[model samples]
Target: MSLLVVGSVAYDGIETPFGKVDKILGGSATYISLTSSYFQKNVNLVGVVGKDFSQDDIDLFKSKDIDLQGLQMDESGNTFFWKGKYHYDLNNRDTLDTQLNVFEHFNPKIPESYRDAKFIALGNIEPSLQAKVLEQVNSPDLVVMDTMNFWIEGTLDALKQTLKNVDLLVINDSEARELADEPNLIKSADLIRKMGPDFLIIKKGEHGALLFTDDEIFSAPAYPIVDIFDPTGAGDSFMGGLLGWLSYTNDLSPQNFRRAVIFGSVMASFCVEEFGPDRLRDLTEKEIYDRYREFRELSEIPEVG
Candidate 1:
């Protein structure tokens, strides 16, 4: 199965209680494509970067067999840059700096070769940009999108327009509440479903994730890890796993959907083990399967008399 991921591709400087890195290959598309590559063979990336984007990162994408036909480069500008520091809990982070150089005017242009992608994952970006990308693709089999509070509060109408096109919407607990203007999660999920997207996944960091369909709901618990690390890109990684699993099997059955959520949780558990994308850089299929079995064991229920 082939998958297309559209989002920022840039450099990130991060600090956490575990450690710090000046700059590394970090972006929503970067993490999503890399994580999804484990399940899907042909992962496509669509985003813009500047001259400052490293050759090493490009080579890394090439090594993963990620199609970069839609990855645009602007020689005159610098790549988007973000710097942040995580609090002791590794959950709360403060954006110390943000410079949208090449990304400031990013206009996602899908190459003719990439317009037929079967699965599309729209990372956190302006609703208008997400909508623009959807316009270029030939009706994808599945469209999953991630959004933040910024778009919900600022460009609501555009967000709703974009939502009308996607199959699934992924957001954190707070964003779901804010978007629905409801305090209770069940009510929030119900309200948001009316806006668009028959399927929604409300992510609660460390707690777990909840998947809601028009008729059913599934909750997957988070994998417990003793040593905490950076939480950046974890959500994108989760979406990658979920989409990757579904794309790999081309199945949307309720059972498959439940398993996909587990796969997503497994990928996210590995994402937070290190800063940036370092941990995912060396993940192998055997390691992924091993962790998946462990997750299964964690979620198994015992029979009662």
Candidate 2:
């Protein structure tokens, strides 16, 4: 099975209490492809970069067997760039700068080879663009989306239109509440289901993640860690791990979906321990399974009654 991911490919400058780093290869597709590469080899990336984007970054994806046929480079433009600084808690951050450059006019074109992908992940991007990618896909068995508050508030109509075509929607708890216009999470998810997607995954940074379906609800706790250097790309990494495991097993049942959530949580735990994309880049399959085993062990509880 193959998975298609659509999102940004750009440079980021990040600062934390520990220190700061200059421009680095960072983007939603970059982290997602890296994490997913551990479990699957046929990851098709769909996004645009600019002439300034390094070929070395492309080589990194190539080394992991990520197919870049769908990746486009704009010869005359510069890549998108973002700068941010993390707070002491690390969960909250302040954006220092954002330059959309090429991404300001990004129009993703789904390659012919990517049209038949079994799974499609619409990473955080303009809602209209997300809809365009969905329209391009010939037949995707599972379609999942990730979005932020910016689009939800600024492009409600576009976002709602895109939501109708996706099977799963992943967003942070705050965005979920804002989108649904409900303060309570459960109620927010219920309201969102009315909008479109059948499944909703609300990510609560450091607290945990919650999954809601029409018939069931599953909750998974975040791996408790004392050190969190940077939270960048954690959500995309989680999505990568979740879809990677699901595609690898070829199982879409609720039971398997719950397991995928745990796998995603574990992968995200590793993501926050280091700076931009460091932890995910060098992860091995054995290491991932080891963390999975520990998660299963810790999550299991004997009967209290």
Candidate 3:
């Protein structure tokens, strides 16, 4: 199953209680594609970067064997850049600066070779842009889209329209609430499902993530780690691990979705242990498998008669 990921690929400056980085490789597509690559090969990436994009980063993508055919290079200006500082709780952040640069005028021109992707992961971006990506690709087996409060507050209508075509919607709990205009998660998920997306995932940050379907709901628990270096890109990494597993197994059963949720949690747990995607890179297959088993153990109390 071919996996196509579309979103921003840019430089990020992050300041957290644990550590800080002035500039590093970071973006929704960057994290999603890299994390997914561990599970699926030939992961296709579509995003724009300026001449400032580093060769090491390019090599990093190639190291994972991620396909970069859809990546665009605009030498006219710098790539998208964002700087933020996280509070002690690591839940809230203050945006210090944002430079869209080439990403501002980004036009997702899917390559002819990538038009037939099997699984599509749309990262957090403008709703209209996400829809444009959908329009360019052929019918994919599964379409997963991630959105944020920004789009919910600004482009609710367009977001809703795009959701109509998406199979799954991945958003934080607050964004889910904001999008559905409901307080309770269960009811909010129902309202959101009615808009579109047979499946809805509400990411609850450190609390874990919830998966909602037409009739079933699965709650995945978070991995406990004392030291969390950076929370940025954790959600995208979860998407990567999730869609990556789905594409790798080509399984869409409700039961399989449960496993995918756990894998998503596993990847997210690793993500916060290091800055950017440092933890995601250099991960061994055995490490992932072992951690997955450990995740299972977290709630696998022996069946009590």
Q: What CA root-mean-square deviation does each model show from the true structure?
A: 0.9, 1.1, 0.8
lDDT of each: 0.91, 0.89, 0.93
Decide which is better by TM-score, 2 or 3.
Answer: 3
Ten consecutive residues with minimal summed lDDT in candidate 2? 294-303
- Tens digit per residue, CA lDDT, model 3, 50-87: 98999999999999999998999999999999999999
Which pairs of residues clash in candidate 3, taking residues 3 or more apart in a chain or in different chains? none
Model 2 earns a TM-score of 0.97
Off by over 4 Å in 1: none
Pairs clashing in candidate 2?
none
What tens digits encode model 2's per-residue C-alpha lDDT throughout 100-144? 998898999999888999998899999999999988888888899
User: What value does the lDDT take at residue 287 in candidate 3?
Assistant: 89
Model 1, 1-305: lDDT tens per residue? 68999999979999998899999888899989989988998899999999988889999899889899889989879999999999998778999999999999999998888888888999999999999999999979889999999999999999999999988999999999999999999899999988888899999988889999967999888899887688888998999899889999999888898889888888999999998888888899998989889888888899999
Per-candidate total of colliding backbone pairs = 0, 0, 0
